[model samples]
Structure formats: C-alpha cells, structure tokens
Target: MSGLTVTLQFSGGAELLFDKVKKREVELPALEKFLPQINKTDWSLRELLVWIKDNLLRERPELFLQGDSVRPGILVLINDSDWELYGELDYKIHNGDTIMFISTLHGG
Candidate 1:
C-alpha cells in the first residue's frame, strides 16, 4: 500500500456516516492495514459482506443478499466506479485510489 484512501458510507441515514473520515488520504500500506478492520472476514469482500448482512443486518427480515449481488441495495465503488463493473471484488486497486463501501439509499 502506497497512498490510498477509503470512504465508507451507509444507507441507513446519517448515523452510519463516518464523521472522522473527511475525504482523507493515506498511504496504500496504511490503507491495506485497515483491510482487517473493514470486515474482510474470509480474505474477500463478498465473504465479508455476507457476514455483515447476516450479523449486522440480521434484524432486517425482508432483506436478502447474495455474494455477487450489486445493485440498489448494495453498491461497492472502487476508485470512483462500481467495482462490479470492473472485475468486482477482484478489481485491482492502485495507490491513491479510493475505495468506497456504500449501502444503497445514500447516493446509489
């Protein structure tokens, strides 16, 4: 990692927005170090989202999620574009690129 940034947002109103991130930038190595903190439970983003949907959003009874699903309810933007459109979770991110994990209902 050598100069990267990650923007995390959510659809559940303002409570989910990170007040501390503030369009900040960090080294790629620093960003990579945060990988463990971003819920990459099984070495992959999809796997992490599965855990998130089950564990975090378990109370949302009507919500159903899948590993490769990317749409209105879920949007993962990497480097300003949808990751799904560019090899999905396997998309390669370079230094200075920003990865934004957003749940729809925000600006999706």
Candidate 2:
C-alpha cells in the first residue's frame, strides 16, 4: 500500500525535545503502523502526535504532551493555519500537509 507522506516542523524551542529537528519529511506506514487499539484507514493529528512521541521525541515527553494531546502553551499549526481551526487533534492527516509545533512555554 502507498504510504501517507507529510512534513513535520518544530520551532520555538520545541525542536529541542525532538532531537533538535526543525523539519522532517515522513512516510507513514499502513494502518498497522498506528496504535493497536486504533482501527481506521485514515490518519489524524491525534495519531500523529502519538507516533511522533514514540518515534521522534528525544526526552521529557511531559514537556510536550498532556494526556492525548499537546500540553497547553504549545501552538499547533496545520498548513500554516491554527490547528484549532480544523478540529485540533481530530484533524485528518493529508498527504503533503505541513504540521508545525511551536512551544510558547519557557523555563526560568
């Protein structure tokens, strides 16, 4: 089966938690690649979040996530628009989509 391809970007110190990767071009595997409990033919940002945490996050998961979504203060943009405009975590993952995570949190 053809894989789903997309672009991922991290910025505003968010990249520090993801091996300092500012951008990535990824090819998501088939449905089997998603969490075992998930059953679907399509991918969503929710699944993408978990996938990123599992495959790309380097450390301190709590800094980036809370429950099933991004911790508060983290801004998510889909194709340059606010993720909230597209149903946030429920937003479907589309090929060539550019998903960006920007951290608005800072530590003293």
Candidate 3:
C-alpha cells in the first residue's frame, strides 16, 4: 500500500498488446527499489518501460517495446503533456502521474 501509484492507459492498437486493457492502475516500488541504476530516489520512464514489458505486458512484447524504448509509431504522453517536452524516456515518474500510450500504427 506504500509505493508510487500511477495510472497507465493504452489506446489505439497499444491496448491489443496488453490483453485489450485500456487503463491500469499500477503501484511501483519505492524510489529505492524501482531503479537504483539511474537514481535511488527516483524512477525514470525508461525504467518504467522495462518494468511494464517485464510485468504488465501479456503477449507480443516486441510490439510494444524495442531495444530500450517503446516501439516506433507509439506516442507517449505524461501527465497530459507530450513526453518529448519532458525528455521522453528520461522523464522522472512521479506518484499519481498518468502515463498514456497510443499506437499510431493501428489500421483505420
């Protein structure tokens, strides 16, 4: 019950790779246990991506992750703002933050 709480949303084709779930509430470990490599006091979106791929992703992970980042054509928004404005993967994930993923590759 004591950890970083955040909301994850998947849209377009992104949800397809996540068991068709559109929204998820995740509780990440404290800063110390989240990702100690970068900063023991914070967790970055980069680490969150890896965590999601390893923990939440139910199938076809490659469709959502590529290398150290999200697959191409997937747009990410953090707290209602484009992640690019906050350094994308480098952005620090805060408690109560909302992260959304939309796959533009989905067919019309």
Candidate 4:
C-alpha cells in the first residue's frame, strides 16, 4: 500500500485475492506478496509475460496498461467487459468500481 497509490485485484487465472500495491514511481517489497513468483513488479504487463515466455496460465499481476505490454491473453476488465471495448486504459475509474484481469483461454 505504501508503494502503490492505486488498488489492484487478481482473478480468472488466479483466485479471489487482493494485491499489495506498488507505485509507478516507487518499487516496494510488498509487490511480491500478491503476484506470482514469475511476475516481475518492475516489468510492465506485456513485458513480464514475454520475459516469462507467455506462461501466464496461473501467473498474473494487477497491471496498469502503462506498466507493461498487454496482449490477447490478458483480459483487463475495467468494470465488467474489456477495457478496450470501453476506451482502452484511458477509461477513468470511479469510486468503488472494481477492475478485473483475466487470462484468455486459447485452445477450445
């Protein structure tokens, strides 16, 4: 909480869990508490995945679009549906609104 100003939630590929935040300007130890071991707090959403070779099945982090390279596997829901369907990351957040990040299942 001391590191990040915004709130981050995890789900879909993971489970019902809340995140310890890390600020855009600052990196803190608390960041590792919520995310998977492969998830680098320093890397952006996209970069982290590629760094780990897209093995994001159970590995996910609460990511802001600015931080990393977001791709198809990562479904970022601002309120409900895709944030891109709404307005990409530019979509503003209101009080008490929840954002969800789900990994897209590829093979049917």
Local accuracy of candidate 4 as per-residue lDDT tens digits, 1-108: 224333334445323222332111222233345455645444232332332233222333343122444555667765577677765544544434455656554345
**Alpha-carbon shift of residue 87 in model 4 (angstroms):** 1.2
List runs of model 3 lying over 4 Å from the truth. 34-39
Ten consecutive residues with minimal summed lDDT in candidate 4?
A: 17-26
TM-score per candidate: 0.41, 0.94, 0.88, 0.39
Residues 1-108, candidate 3, lDDT per residue (tens digit)? 248899999998899888899999999876566565654567789888988987889998888889999999999999989999999998978889999999998564
Candidate 1 per-residue lDDT over residues 21-87, each given as its tens digit: 3244432234335455663322334543443344344344233244354345656677678776877
Can you give the lDDT of residue 105 in candidate 1? 54
Give the least accurate 10-residue stretch of model 3, judged by summed lDDT: 31-40
- The window of 10 residues in a row where model 2 has the poorest summed lDDT is 30-39
Candidate number of the best lDDT: 2
Using lDDT as the measure, name the better of candidate 1 and candidate 4. Answer: 1
Q: Model 3 residue 76 lDDT?
A: 97
1 or 3, greater by lDDT: 3
Q: What local lDDT score does residue 58 receive in model 4, on the 0 to 100 scale?
A: 31
* Greater-TM-score candidate between 2 and 3: 2
Candidate 2 per-residue lDDT over residues 1-108, each given as its tens digit: 247899999999999998898999999877555655767768889888888998899999999999999999999999999998999999988989999999999989
lDDT of every model, 2 decimals: 0.46, 0.90, 0.87, 0.42
